[model samples]
Target: MSPDIRDEAVEMWFGPQHVSAHGWAAKLTVVGDFIVECDPHAGYFHRSAEKVLEFRTFKQGPLVLERMCMLEAFLAEYPYISAVEQIAGVEVPERAKVLRTIMMEASRIHSLQFWWGQFSAELGLFAMTLWPWVDREFFLDTFEELTGSRHAVSFSTPGGVRYDFNEKVLKKLDRALQRLEQHLPKFKDMLLRSPTFRMRTKGIALFSYEDALRWGLSGPNIKACGVPMDLRKDWPDLNLAYDLVDWEVPVVDNPDHPGQSDAYDRMVQRFLEVETSINIIRQLLPQIPEGPIVDPKARAKTNRLPAGEAYGRVEGTRGVTTVWLKTTEKAQTPYRAKIRGPCFASYYSLKHLVPGSTFADFIVVFGSLDPYPGWWDR
Candidate 1:
């Protein structure tokens, strides 16, 4: 409590060891455990992914870039593939369109499952992490069986999904969804009754509706703040006309608890979204039409996009991720390409959240926000 000690600079090695440190070592500057500053010493697992993409063929980059974030493979690839397809002027098949919608929802569920689990872990609740991961694994297995890879399927291509499905695959997806429906209520009860979890997060790390809007927060962050701007329902053009599918955007009324966009509300909103994603998958599966996976037999093993500039974006696992491609008129390689990740906005908000809070609260707030650094560092 002495003023001299308080004013003295102190540095600490906070974590390269924590489970939620996002696979990097962080050297945090602490004014006695309050984390006045943080320097993220990134690249503990860096593979020079962005640079490597240039060496790979256009078709090959999809697989390589998908690995940029293990939890967000779909969102990462969707934009890339969409951009390539746009430059090539290829029309995606209707069956492929429906499949992309279903796959995207499944991927969204996978990432949110991880986020929900981590949110509970941050609150010191272990069961919440366990149950949802176990349930989500079923979908992972389904993706693996369908696409030949679980985490980074590389299933999507410029024009359509790389593969098609059969009746049996649909049946399997239906069964897994049925299990999710059955167990979700139990998961809800566990979170609802956990007094400590509720107390720790209920009103902490609050963000107002204005704060969310000002910061350009989307997905569950917006939903948690009592806004109903779901990309699937509200902005269908983003997904190449995914509106034909029937689904509801879940919304909440928290005017009494106005500006109640705290860690608790964020977690609760994700839980609700997990349910909505499951419903979307269930509804989309049976209605999926029978058709060829890809038609016209793509021009070459590797696609050469036309020389021009195009930016494609998709509502990803975290929020909105965009890809900008500029091609030289004749060259097979891209002249320039850019990836815009969603986590940057969420991470930037830490400046606003951390100053007045204690260190443990910092971890709780960061984990609840679920800013995946692998995507950001890329």
Candidate 2:
């Protein structure tokens, strides 16, 4: 190589196993330590989610959806449940609606906590790891008490949730929210305020607002770019009971950068969302109505929706997670069923950010965008 050239461009793989590679792996073409191109790789874990759901009855489908998103089961489960309930023409009780909102926000916090922990570790903030997990127990405890499991929470049924809300779990949720709120500031101080984080991420991995719209980035990813595209606010499901709550959707912006989408902005938007989720949980618990959790008519697989089709979507912890289902009177099972996850769209956009940044910058950029391989590849 010439002296001016320094190093010839060579390809490198970052994870599926790299310690710093947060979610999955990516292939990178690098000149020295700088990446010239990037290709994110997934499918290391694929269970054929749609195919598994298609053959099962409506009541049994959530079991498969829950596994698709290991980090946020509610995101996958809610959309499928809503799709089936809509097709079945089952009315979700008012109590179930508020409870679902509580779980959704809780799950949102759960997902962010996991992301933050990994991102912090990537930034060499080992101390940051302990706090999120310490606080996470409160959320998991609430879930375990509610559903007898911590991770794969297949809690929602077709018409409504499988379990009823109890005073003890609500009390635990209340206490957990308080703990999370109190501890939230430490993350901001340790990571967001750290010059290292800002320097590494503030303007790196930019996705312009126009690009966000064109590429269909959703949730906090697009919201960070000032797109104002929250499914909860823009397309609220009746069962979501979003109308019952009073909270502003946060489209986080970097006042310093002005009309920009960067890794820092994305992280900040999700950070703001974490606080919003806490507030939502507090707002909802007092207002949850007292009634049966699920209609008896909905718990069974025999309940047939109209032969037509319906699509159900939720403002997932990730983004606007969706489910499409088609039914026919000729057979009890769904004729067609599938899920659409948000991470899939953002995956292709990786090369757009990866090239023109250093290899280390690639990790920060990828982690900030928070792509999940498992969400796709199925």
Name the top lDDT candidate. Answer: 2
State the lDDT of candidate 2 residue by residue for 1-378, as single tens digits: 345443577877887776675457788877877777788777777778788877887778888888877678877788888887777677777888888888878988988998888887887777887789888889899998998899888888877788777888888888888888888897788888888778888788887778877776788888898878888888878877778879999987677766668988888898899988887887887898888888776656436656878898888776778889888874567888877888887876787877888777777876777767767677
Model 1: residue 84 alpha-carbon error in angstroms: 0.9
Quote the lDDT for 252 in model 1: 61
* Candidate 1 lDDT, 114-221, residue by residue in tens: 777877877778888888898788888878778888887887877677877766667667766878889878887888668887788776778877887777777677
Per-candidate TM-score against the hidden true structure: 0.90, 0.94
Poorly placed runs, candidate 2 (over 4 Å): 1-7, 300-302
Candidate 1 residue-wise lDDT at 263: 80
Clashes of each: 0, 2
User: Whose TM-score is greatest here?
Assistant: 2
